[model samples]
Target: MYKLQVVKELHSSEGKMILDVDISVQQGSFTSIVGKSGAGKTTILRMLAGLVKPDKGSIHSGEDIWFDSNTRKNKVPQERSIGFVFQDFALFPNMSVLENLKCVQSEKDEEQIKELLSLTGLTALSGFRPDALSGGQKQRLALARALVRKPKLLILDEPFSAIDQETRIRLQQEILKIHKAYNLTTILVSHDLTEVLRLSDYVIEIGNGKIVRQGNTDLFFSNEGKTDQFRMTGQVVDLICENEKCFAYVVVGTMLIKARVEDSMNTALGIGDLVVLSLNDFNPIIKKIKP
Candidate 1:
């Protein structure tokens, strides 16, 4: 079991705030932490990963003291058995997909690395660099690299926030498969409420740098049911107006989709107007995306 009780002084969007969290996570279970912007969601994960220092408190995992303020005992990030995936992918721009994974391993395990590549569906792009891969591909590479450490705790900080909706959905499934295959205790930080309920066994809600609620995912969102609208931000690359109906071709990261324009004012779409594509029941429609 993993237990965390930490306090830290932080400067968030809400100004000076104290991050006080006391939480426990079960072994081999998936949990997600969610909160408003600047509520100290990422800070908690960073502290747990040893990337950020807590002002006080302790962190223990299975009788091991990862951090203790009173004793001044702290383990460096490498010492803690953790695999952290960041939203920005945090990949080496100069390295290929294979090299990124190998960089995290102190002792090379060729078979394990190959298996990770296959598991993440990156075998074909093993030789490609981060610049050559799509947003979704880079995120996959990031995840694979984290697993190279064979970590006991996996922390994800909004890892799918940068990807398109379609890729995000697929990657979510892939992550669950990875989590179960390794039997690792996983914790994810995401802003999407539906996503939290979909992937996590347990959900935690933080507000103003404190945990407001934490419980089983099903119970937390049982009354809400599924989400009605899914939105994707994309740039319009092509548009055609025929008989007062405008059809737009928008590019969302690596995916190109065609959408029917229907804005609030029924304005004509330009060739380069940024748009938001909303999907419900596989039918995607377009609207003006505000900056």
Candidate 2:
């Protein structure tokens, strides 16, 4: 398991933003930290990656202590066993796919590098430079490069947000595949709800300098975490029933969600009715919005 407890002051165009984070993640779990901009989501990842230092507190993964402000023990970014994938692919424009993978490797392991290229389906483009590859291909190369060292913790910061929807979905699947294949503990910071719901085993929502809502994916669906930030508020924009199963199209903010309405939902439930959706069970629960 990994635990991060840190406090830091950040300066932005608006003002000082204090980030107080205390979170634990189980080993091999795919965790997603989500929130609006400047919610301290990425900061937490940076701190974990040893890219940023905290004013106070510590970070631990398994038996290794990554940081400890009290002891003045801090691991440099290179010392921490972390694979960080950035929002931009961040590949070396001058390096070929093979060279990029080789640069991060602590030791030359030919088979491991070959495996990564194949795992990300970049074997064919192994000699191609970042500039020559398409966006999706570059993203895949970035993922491949991050895995070169076989880091125990994989941190992704909105790595797929730049691509088109279809490509994003495909890459999401690829990440999941790599996670399981390596038994890696993965952490992602993304604002896309569907991606979070689809990828995360645990979801943490940060806001107001603290965790606004958090739980394993299951808790978001149950009644226990209804107040969580993962809750969705929407109005039924359309309803259809066919073959004994009912479906409702709900407009949640700017996103449209389609739910398989259970039999419990009365037939009288129609268009324009307010509804609440929860993100536990990795399934969205459709319920009438309470007064």
Q: Per-residue lDDT of 1-291 in model 1, one digit per residue for the tens?
A: 999999999986657999999989999999999888899999989888899989999999989999999999999999999999998889999999998988889788999999999999999999999999999999999999999999999999999888887788789889988998999999999986646655788988899888987788656654333324488886765566788876776656424566777654345566456788888788787887665
Error of 1 at 79 (Å): 0.7
Tell me the number of clashing residue pairs for each predicted model.
0, 3
* Residue 153 in model 1: lDDT: 98
Off by over 4 Å in 2: 221-258, 261-291
- lDDT digits (tens) for residues 214-239 of candidate 2: 88754542323233456888777567
Q: List the residue pairs that clash in candidate 1.
A: none
**TM-score, each model?**
0.77, 0.80
For model 1, how big is the CA root-mean-square deviation? 9.4
Highest TM-score against the true fold, candidate: 2
* lDDT for position 99 in model 1: 89
